[model samples]
Target: MDYSYSEHKQCYVALDCIIFGFDRKDLKLLLIKRNFEPRKGDWSLMGGFLESDESLDEAASRILSSLTGLKDIYLEQLKGFGKVDRDPVARTISVAYYALINLNDHDKNLLPEFGAKWFPIDELPNLIFDHEEMVSLAKARLRHKASNQPVGFELLPDTFTLPELQQLYEAIYETSLDKRNFRRRILSMNVLEKTDKKQKKYSKKGAYLYKFDEDKYSEQKNKNGGTKMMFKPPKV
Candidate 1:
């Protein structure tokens, strides 16, 4: 039963990545300034057209690696954009994915090689086409997941101070969280181990450094039957 009537509609597929990074004080997005056609000299999420021999996930990883020149990043598929007119050039569909990377862990030397620049999430320029919508959705998702899970930790250095962790969340939610409440909640999770090391760069007295204990965190989650461990934020 082979049907050979070539009357089906076909369209191109694209994979776009929203890469998030934290620079101790601000949360940023990694974008590329395009120099080619369609939208020359415009800032947009890094993306590429789907190739013939790859699955959507593989294409996404390839697109991300091509820009970051790294592997095994915290990548999550956000959603798909299939608005018939989303792309002015053609009737194409885009699958969006967001990644979280600790700024300290990434290699800056590769940034220039890929024409990628880190822009503060608040002061971002006008993105090409519907990329602004994609960014908005990603931010909402990040804020939601961060409230209950430690996924926000993916944007911090391996070893950090309590104040540093606070700053990260503050930047993520774009609001001031109660200092005492934030610290108390995070410490109560039992996933952080205080190190003798202190960060004296900002304060003369220095603040104690702490590292995220993955094993403890996992055990606690298992013990709690995978409940939503909330790091509640201050009410606006």
Candidate 2:
């Protein structure tokens, strides 16, 4: 028997943001502690309901902005999660959005006050609901994205050194990379502007700094699909 549109049960759609940040050496994920009922005090992704007059993108933006005061962030839709009982308080079909944020740039106090905190991906604790799985998928996407696009730069400051860039990739891949090969591929892209500045804090050699040439990078990405940064992990 076919049911008419009038007979369909009304449900709610929520947007959850998995904000990822990179800080030179480690990759961090933004998580919030639920203050309301159902799972109060448990760490979960930043989320809110999709308003009747707003699109999913709009709602996601609103939710992210409300929690962290971040705007114009780079976000992509992940899969929709609706397991009926995924939310114990009510039936909610949540659409997940993965975002990249530069931690060095974002206001640190904006999050903690909202019951949110940044946790290192590897050091993440137990989370509420299916959040753990969501984080796992996000990590895989980050890895796949980093190899193609200049994603590591998203987590770094406007200017950085080759060693700093390598460290970001190493953190994402969770393995040390060949410095020589890494530098070669990055330099070959012609999208990095080598600055005269040096970062001598980490080394006595004082590695030269570089910044992404946004226009060149965009042109290269459009013309060549993307620049590939392939560094195989050491064999176990």
Candidate 3:
């Protein structure tokens, strides 16, 4: 190998994260209002230039943790955007990653420092550059994965009611689910363990709270031939 090849141009590599969260009411997106150019003061996904020492995946995780102060999050690479003009200031190619996180879990103190804010998915402000397209692709990827896997649980609290879980599915799929069928299918999987605690915030007679049964989930995965817990929905 030639030790020095100055013939090739070096362009910047960046990672952009489309973080998803659920607030027990609706699905949300975590966006930042960039404080510096090239699109200063515009809404955008959390991003950072790839450092010389880190892999692309490491860069994604670092960008996410810097915003949330949490690690081992559910993150996946969506795709790369390499359009010639995708980035205004440089010949930068961006790898887009999507993350699912519990809404109440992140460090809120960090948001102000980053100018980060949660926007309801439907009400997001205009994003800079190709960031808007990045969100659309990320959402489609999320829906497809969530259709086959219980990854949606990453956006939920430790314990939740059946109603809350149903709402989460509805939020994820963006369609109304038959409440009866939804509950039946979920309980049929037998992956949730009922807890003695009841969530009374909804009413005087609150819905029972349940936590995901890791043991049962593992058994189900084995029974499923290690396909990862199936979260397929009924024909709704």
Candidate 4:
């Protein structure tokens, strides 16, 4: 086999994080005000160059931890943005990763150092470079991920109600789902355990609380033949 150096060119690869958190019944994104030149003082995603000694996951963790004092978050590489003119100063390709974290679990002081701020997804301002596109993709991925995987737990408290869970989905999907059907579908999955507790914050009737059933979830995965349910609403 013959190799041609001309067929390939060397370029810098960077990792950008689209850190997502849920709060006040809304979806929010973690954004940093760029402190370096080329786009200094502009809003952008948290990003850094991939170092030679680290794997992609390691580099992502390092970058996020450095900016927000966070580690071990639900991180997954989204995709690579590799247009020749993406970066004005250099030929750099950026691999974006979307991370999920419970708003109550993260450090309260993560914003001071890098000028970080959590902005609601709908109210996001114009971002520098290709970050705006990355944010849009991350939001769509978040909706798909929450539907199929249990990753939404990363954004909720250890204990939650069915309504709380439903609201989380509604916030991400931006639509109201029928309460009865939502509960039926989720309960039918056999992956959630109803608890002895009830939450009364939203109504006087109060709603039963629930937690994820990790063991049954594993078993369900193995079987993969359980009855699938969908929520149906009564006439308004």
**Top model by lDDT, which number?**
3
| TM-score, cand. 1 | 0.95
Candidate order by TM-score, highest to lowest? 1, 3, 2, 4
User: How well is each residue in 23-90 modelled by candidate 4, as lDDT tens digits?
Assistant: 84888888988888888899999899999999988999999888767788899999999999999999
Stretches > 4 Å off in candidate 1: 3-5, 234-236
lDDT of 1 by residue, 38-154 (tens): 899899899999999999888999988877777898889999999999998899999999999988777788889778899998999999989999999999989888887788889
Q: Which pairs of residues have clashing backbones in candidate 1?
A: none
List TM-scores for all candidates, in order.
Answer: 0.95, 0.90, 0.94, 0.88
Each model's C-alpha lDDT? Answer: 0.89, 0.83, 0.90, 0.83
For model 4 the local lDDT of residue 65 reads 85
Candidate 2 displacement at residue 218 in angstroms? 2.5
Worst 10 residues of 1 by lDDT: 227-236
lDDT of 3: 0.90
lDDT of 2 at 24: 80
Q: Which lDDT tens digits does candidate 3 get at residues 27-57?
A: 9999999999988899999999999999999
What is the TM-score (0 to 1) of candidate 4? 0.88
